[model samples]
Target: MQGSSIAVDKIATELWAAEVIPRVKDAVVYLDDHMAEALHWNRGLAWLLDSGALAVRELSYFESGLSKAEEKAVFIVGEPLVGPCLSRIAAVVRASCFTCCTVITSCPPAAHHSALYGAVPQQELRDSFLHVEEQLLDWMGNMNFSTTVIYAPLALVSVAPNFVIMPQFQDVFPTLPAPQNTNDSCNKELGALPRHLQTSIQSLVGNLCSIMNMLNVKPDVFSLGQTSHFIGEELERCSRSSRKERGLTLVLVDRTMDMAGALTSACDSVMDRVVRVLPPFTKGHSIDVQVDMSSLCAASRSTAESGISNSVAPGCLSHRDSEIAMHHLVTAKQKECLMELNRLLVEWGSRNGLRLDVGGRLTPQLLQKRVNQFRGTSRNVLQGGLLQQVLGVARALSHPGAAKLQDQYGAEKLLLQNAVANGGSPVVQLLRSRHSMGLSLEDVIVLLTLLYSLVGEKALGDDECLLKAEIVQAVYQAAEKDELPLFLHDLLRENVHEENAVLAAVDHMFDVLPGLGSTADTPKHRLLLECSNSGTQPAVYKPLTQQLLHEILQDDPTLQLVHHAGGLTDRIKSGFGFFRAAAKPHPRDNPVIMLFIVGGVTASEAKLAFDVVSSNKINKQVIVGGTALAKPQEQLRLLFQRQFR
Candidate 1:
């Protein structure tokens, strides 16, 4: 894991030095806040900007500070879809300044082209591209500065650039690549797909090649899926000669092919607990919790005889402290930890003549004072601001409303498991009593969709069918009322007709490795039991891809290195057979394995790849990269929008 971090940092730094630093001089940098935060760009940017390479006047967020500087500037845009906005911002900034401006995006030119004209009909794609090009040229001409556009197509966290976390484009265009237009009689069928998808695929392939070049990885074998055969061919064309000694294998898979793993809710994991209680995991690992300092001060005053000091102000806690608190809150086994901390706070406040309530606000001073008071104890519960934050999160999670929602989530999970294992009646009765479950209508729909994905139409009984219909009707009514979008109706309909390939894969995975789906109390049930048992809180979830890779690489003998020209679907068939191969000795002591997920990857999955390689579990160094990092909800929402809109 440490090695992975080092590698990622090295790559990000090298890329920054090579592309960004040399071009930036006495320029105001407009940073895309979202991308910066997601990719942990601060570290690299800070090192470069602070190192005196570029005389950066000021750093500004993309939305703000565009017109603040009347000087040459560098605009780091997030993606090509935001080209218009970026152009507008640059135009506004240029109006006030006569200096040249350079626009650098984390996406390729193809992404921008795709955004502008990819959706047009194949025949009209050229005209649309030309129109967009003309508009961009006109816009640039009006600006006072000479504008240059550079495509970085690099979205990686400074801490793990080797993982190469890409954006989840498939979520937006769920039915993309338009299947294989099999109507051979029609000439148009040959080029039925929108130009954008093709360009995007090419850009992705290009990005992969760049990464390979950066890493100096020459694989002896390429195991690509049908959708990604082009990547293999490109790699083959680029390779000078194969080095079998390295024994590197590249595995590329489509997200749709593994929907069950991507969409299924994690059971009994730290991620599950955190997601159930806290806000959704969007782009980053941190979450903000609004802490009421005034209330806490008031509570402290009431509890302690010595009036609490007015030095502590009311505001949100530090992000670092809050992150620490959240980590402990999610991993904590004893709920009483929060109560104990709360009790300690009140006790200390009372001793200091400060009045406090049971659910009072927590401040740094209060925490420090408590820590000082408990210094004599062997285990300092109030060691850091973490205790205070943990108590805050606990209070929120323990709320009646939050507790009820958690129960509903658990119930939903059970329903999914039961449906998949026993083919039981759909939980219509439970869903109908919505008031009792305290679940939102959207939650119900999501759960039902999950079940639909697993069971398929043929497996669902009459009662289950009726339940599904009722849920659909409710969803439709919500859509009519604008609580839900009209597209959801189409999404639900399409979900019902989805092929059972994902389901079959899920069954096969569980059959081969029961521990994966095991709910047993054994250590095998949890992926990172070693970390947990060692009293170290894991930074991220054990990635599903890592788990799958570990299982496949451990003592698998039948699998031999082979170069195949098939797509993801074909590769999956062969891959599983290879996984099922008996354990055999390898030629090399340590081999190189390359794993790529086509649609997108989660941060947790990326971390797991690093961990596995660092642990030397398979006695091999693994290089993992993906198309993007996307949340499950985002993926589902994208699918819905694609189907309906």
Candidate 2:
């Protein structure tokens, strides 16, 4: 799998350098705090403006910076939100003494205008737009500075937006990309959009096309999964050369295509460990992490093989030393420094005829002496100082409480896997028993939803139905206790009902269709199963879309099958001429396969696409991208908010 972090960072950096930076002088870059964290915007902007020219500040500081500056350029980079701070900043920018100002926003023109004016009627929206434009023009009438507004839409389809600020469930639907030839009204949301939420999605599509054009690679085949017709259509419209070349394949799918994967919490992976331990770590970027020294020390001591005394002086290292230690520990390059420090510590202990322990501490003066000696030579001093800090944090994360939570997650995963693989009364019985897995109500709901997706309503027996009802009631009650919106319970119930209906319809079609029923026993079906879940714990727990891409690319199968859950299957089949015949058998020719998830994709999914190609397989390449990378909790919260709020 490819590391999307690098790709996104590179893209953002390239875009900024090529487009945003050169146009301005003495610019103050105002970054959305959340976007800064999500896209590592600060790092990208800094790298692009290498001459220490970029004054990177939080969006909150825009007004303050405006107040302090005169005849300087101000660049506001963020989503359009009409909060008091943003309104004040907008007003101030119009009146500021900035010579050359630029507003590079992620939001599309329509969404930006809506945020400024608030949602209003069509006539009112125009009036508001004119009013804001007039206000800005009047304010800047006498100013010498030139102002530029750039809508740098981030049409991020393969990856979810911010997990912290999740979209509502209504916003999760696939959005039809606005036609390039369409008028400005195409961007506006004057009435309830008959298709999908165009606000964020339109910008997302536009940005995606921009990125694709920038890269100069045209795809050969575009296989869109169910409900992803809109994105596929947009890609087709934008990338004419890709369609003509017909060498690269692009697959677009929705989140609901693999709902089970999205809802299930991952276990036993580096990514999972990071997600579990580092709550504040957003999008794999290191932030200012708050460490509880006492708790960490206690946890470390308890887990240590030979318990070392905690008699070390509290102020052994100065506050500066502590901060430096933390920086060394968290920074990526310091891994080598840490290793060298470990080797040196072992050597020192051996030379001094002193026993070295994991929890052992040395006096401040001794540690400082060692650090000072290695200050110019090696990073050992800093590493040694931070050893406790790192070890303590790791140990604390491995505490019994965390272990129990993992155990619960594991149990839930096991049950779901078994339910999918071996569907019978036993799984239903287990589901019915509240204490069988010792899982929480939410976990049960997730498992139940997965089961519903796997086994159709017609296939489910009375016992399973009863168990489903019981679980639903339990989840509803639990939500009430937690003060969560009651609609969340209803949403889950609705999801189960929808899944049942869809699966039942699929089953019916298979039964009625002549060749489809028999095809289930073929190797193609087996391949789909392998891609979805390789019948292994790691595969099952990992992102399904990623695992599928990995297997398809690694095995280099002559015939590749792409499965989607929505109505776009026919559209994809029709668009891709190779799969035109509905009853045709798998082709023996080695063909590139594409898989896409529509609603959102996890980080794991994005990684697999990059990883698969890096293997340098001949004619074996997989392209994976998604709308977003949303967490289970975030998705659930969005669903709740969509239904209730």
Candidate 3:
């Protein structure tokens, strides 16, 4: 043979201070690349190269930090995870289940054997999270494999209707590869991540998916394709021969199907932040989310204006302006929401070790102004945006990913219920008031206008301008009651319309909601939010009372005897059908501000929820949350059911 060269995965490099290389007191001549290369070129020169750098990533963690290509970091699996000892010169990657600690080390021998290998399966485990196939755990308790790393993103795999048929986790583990961006929505932009970390995650997720798919039933074409274990093992052998320092990442998911953990009732808790706060159209770093309402109409008049630079609008000037105003309002609210969340984070950081950026804090006076601006902007985004035309986006997203599982009709029914329950436009509630009755023309107009404003447009109703300011003041007066979401249902219903008089609320609602829209061409979607017994969550993803509003709306919007109340005729005759008007906060209910974080949540649904929740400016709510606020199913199950199964 003429020549052959084998390249190792690891390479040593020098560290520079400013631009200068520092002198070492003591050093091992592990690598002399020139000689190594020369030896490769000529086997006769091999004796000239004495040694090379250590391949132990763990050892590198203890040595001073080196250029990324220089040091290998070790993987740790223990408490105080990534602690000072691990973080200090040694670069360490730790893999762990957030809802657990010391998985293999926690239990005693006999008990551990029974729990891990015994025939008895934990009820809660099967009910709350996904069940672990007997074969997968066999590798763990049986020690068939050493230091196995499970790689499938838990959220994806955990969502099957039945576990008895789902592929085993072990079959998915060994071939584990890193997660990849299957599409724009997957959010896995490789270049966006640090090089080393990127490869690690990709390998982890890819391997898992590959192995899992090789078994029983293959994933759907529209779904994440699985990788095989044989391929995984081959790759492993190559890596070992190359003496690669393999680090690991383990992602745990619990929510599988939308039905079992219906996330629909989370409008106040989740969705609003996404539409208004996240603004998918936006790009780059700064929150320069300025949208000129006047330009919106121009975009629609001419297709040239509808391009990316224009952002939105493809119709009449007024409609365009309306949409633009919606964007402007949403942007304004995001800043304010950011301010509010920053305040909470700062306090939390003070209590803990996290020191949030000082600039994010809002003073008491500025806070008041920010709140007003945010609420005003939110009102616009809700009323003018595409979602406003297509009603129930809030209800749909609030339950993250629920709309996907159900058929269109099923989805519509769910949304209709949600609209009604949230004290939907007067039209919906009115129609719902009497099972056989329908809304009058005037009622429909008012209802549509209300729905528009609720999405993100300027409301033309009683809560406008100074009236709104007064209502806000009144809300503060009875702040305690506002948090009691149940009491706010009537207010949410009546004021939603009353808040926007000029917009012809009911018609606008039809324009936006899927079933009510003018065209069959518009793809229809509905939400079927359900939580299964196995999703190891401690409580509902949101407050129980918040969810009840949609239930109430879908049930009945009338109190019969009264002209508007949703009950019977006798009560209406006695003014029972009428509800007391209280645009301003009263002692029974006050406006509330909430904070949500979805940092731990893995699904795009969770990230989108964060974006939606961060944009709310509703009368009774000033909530903020996103990916960071999402509580994992495991955490919920632990808190709700001891998470022991």
Global lDDT of each model?
0.45, 0.42, 0.25
Cα lDDT tens digits, model 3, 1-645, are 011111110000110111111211121111122112211212111122222322322223334324434322212111111224223312222221111111111111222222233322222121111122222234223333222121121111111010000111111111112223223232233233333223333333333333222221121111111122222222332232222222211112212111112223232322233332223222211111222232222333224422223544221111221233322223334344344444543453354443434643454334323222322233344233332211222222222233322232243233333343442322333333322333222222323322332222222223334423433333333333343122222223345324343123222222233211211111111222223432332222222112222222223332111011112542454454345452311111222222111112222233233343343322332222111122222222211121111
Candidate 1 versus truth, CA RMSD in Å, comes to 11.3
- Tens digits of per-residue lDDT for model 2 on 357-415? 53334432233333233223233433343544443334334434346556656765565
Off by over 4 Å in 3: 1-160, 163-211, 214-645
Q: Residue-wise lDDT of candidate 1 within 213-319, one digit each (tens)?
A: 66555544343233445445545444434333333456665444334444444422222333334442233333223333323332343233221224543222223
TM-score for every candidate vs. truth?
0.60, 0.59, 0.20
RMSD of each: 11.3, 11.3, 27.1
Name the regions of candidate 2 deviating beyond 4 angstroms.
Answer: 1-9, 23-25, 38-57, 60-73, 78-99, 107-135, 139-145, 153-196, 241-248, 266-268, 282-405, 417-438, 458-596, 606-624, 638-645
All candidates in order of TM-score, best leading: 1, 2, 3
Candidate structures ordered by lDDT, highest first: 1, 2, 3
How does candidate 3 score on lDDT? Answer: 0.25
